[model samples]
Target: MIPIDFKGKRLVLFGAGRVARLMFSRFPELNVVAFADNDSAKHGTFVGKVPVVQPEALRHLEYDLVVISTGWWESITAQLQALGVAPSRIVLPPKNMLAINNGEKPFSHAPTKALALEVLGCVADFSARHAIPIMLDFGTLLGAVRDGDLIPWDDDIDFSLNDHAYPLFVNHLADLKVALPKPAGCDLDMTVLEAEDLITGVAVTYRNAVGCNAIVPFEIGFMRRVIENGQSVTKGAGPSFIAPEVHFHNVGSITFLGKQFCTPDDALGYLSYVYGDWKTPRQDVTLAEYPMQESEYLETSRTLV
Candidate 1:
């Protein structure tokens, strides 16, 4: 998941905090030779039997990679670079790990869980009122099923609507804006942007009263069922690979933020098809980077639908 092949490679974990301990525990295959920390008190300590040394020790030690386990990666990276450590050998932890456990705050300074739940609730209510079928998609769906909440590092929520529901929901954009709540001391707004070949949905944003532009945007993707090479597949707006139509045929519910929301009928299977290892949290790549061959969909063609 860290994107590095650990086989026969020596590793030095920088920062002897919880993040370092977690990395050591999770990766049994890592040849962690030592831990480098800046704190003087931790210089002589041990993290899971691996001795901790000062950052200066790195110059004398031989290792293949130096994993920056702390959330303060920018400063640590600069420190490592000053110490003459190769940028190629330094690795940062996944965004999920940093946001969930490393004291990294979510965007807009809003409470991550509370804001995400509020936005999701609004969307759910609107869908129900309009009788428009919608389902969680991409990272939003993965976070709901895997983490039981929005991924703290995620900037927005993702929802999917079929071609039929897309236009209907777009037509009732005014109703959705009315439904969006303007909590006291906050300003909320929504707008729809159009592309060359498709109509993109609106993004719900929240701005605080103190002139802080803390926005939690949510997007609805328009997906259509079409035949590709005699096989039924699902295609979304913009250039994207076709997915198996079966995954989007029905909707199911999952408990997210202590409330039930719709998801693809086979949530687990759908994730597996999109993200090869849905259980692992990754920040190095996104859904857009995933190739069609990596999924259960049509493998012969990588053509964008």
Candidate 2:
């Protein structure tokens, strides 16, 4: 979808986390009058030039609407109502409206175990052919580290590349796929997504035998910060890290689908750093996993062929 244009509309984003930053950049027409957050300490701070105010400030501020970007939108909406912003003035972002840099689609489905492995092999081979290294991330990492294979309940694949290697691969994704010595039998499509010259996300997608859209998604970012007990996660900073750079500083290999794939040295700690309940399997998954998003510093969107 084309990036939304909310020009001239004054907007007050409720949460100042990962999703909020995506909203901030998705709408170029939006005249973000102010940002509201419960974090009083951050009130005087700025999300770019726009100031973040205490939620209560919405009572007296003149704006068009209060955009609730947090997961707890119900509570935030009621809070905004009590703060005197009209109920109709509050809204949740349209479905799949979140900003994405990875080559991802608004919708995706899982693949068969064989297809999943093939995708992984394709990525590894492609990376090796070009001399670019890739790291397993998110559920894909969990599967390798936890079960040494893709999670049965999982539907896609994930990997990470340092900011530098990501674009190099994305720019040549299609050509590389076409050049694979013996490509996977599945139909393949790949893309590189960008906003304002920064790579956001990339995906190698294919249709499995079951007619499911299997995606091997990659995000470009650094694991920059630490989390606390999984209660508070840095939002809107862009996740797009399986672990911090230091953890990935030492890399090792794990047998995934009978092939050696790279993983972080402190695999358990890296898992803990991202998903706290790493030991227990949470089979229930959605596109909305990885709660934080990197702040979009600019609003330009482009695609590389």
Candidate 3:
């Protein structure tokens, strides 16, 4: 488990659900501001006098640590990420605790496939209705889904829009009923373009860039910008197609740890580049192997999936 130093940092809590109450009782020394949740029913209520406020009210507040104390963990994480939370700020109890708990309500410790599919559906529906185009992305276990049927251990979905369309996403969201979860770096979410490097995988899913972990909510609106430039176009002839491919530049190699890793980046990079950048399509690359694929080429790869 990763240990976080809380010696002299501002911390906040969200959701006054059972988990929030339990955590507060156990770690009273932590500087907790109050609770933030989507349930309107919980508004005006207080958890031990820490007010249960709506998410919007705390958007401008700053915090070094934000604890997610909710059961719909994956969905909450998605909302938070959209708002601009950093991935390292979120967590749940270890797998041991998760395995043993069997209460009236199922405990969600991390993002699950069930959650991934739901998020995918939600984003897809929203984008389509608003005429927003998206590139359906699959990564990791999601990649396996594309390669075969292997179930990945984690959960996430990917959809990416180039630099131009992000602002429109923010304007659209500003008028919605959606409620974002406040987590770490919530106030800094507006700085996503500057705070972190935008990493892309030549052969992985879009969500893979922002996988499991804690993040904050952003109202500055990169997503809206993405939606604005996305458009729908028809495919081949006789029938009508509404999905136009979103525009993206082919990034040659990704620099990590001060080193540039080329695609056919992995052996898969070879296949993806061939099928994509090089314009020479290869039917499933996972189907066959240069056999020692894992040990030969991938053995020394240092990038963390």
Q: What TM-score does candidate 2 get on C-alpha atoms?
A: 0.53
**Please, what are the lDDT tens digits per residue for candidate 1 over residues 10-114?**
889888876578767756677899999988999888987899999999999989988877545666788999999999988765533322222233433456446
| Candidate 3 lDDT score at position 128 | 51
Using lDDT as the measure, the top candidate is 1
Give the per-residue lDDT of model 3 (tens digit) for 1-305.
11245435565566666556765665556566767788799988887767777766656767776666544455666776676667676544321111111111111323333333333445445555665444333232123324332123222232344444444543455322142222332121111221123211111112212453332110111121122224322111111112222323332233322222221113344334223432332222221111111111111111222
Q: TM-score each candidate.
A: 0.53, 0.53, 0.30
Sorted by lDDT, highest first, which candidate order results?
A: 1, 2, 3
TM-score of 1: 0.53
Against the reference, the lDDT scores of all candidates come to 0.65, 0.59, 0.37
Better of 1 and 3 by TM-score: 1
Q: For residue 146, what is the lDDT in candidate 1?
A: 92
Give RMSD to native, each candidate.
Answer: 13.7, 10.3, 19.4
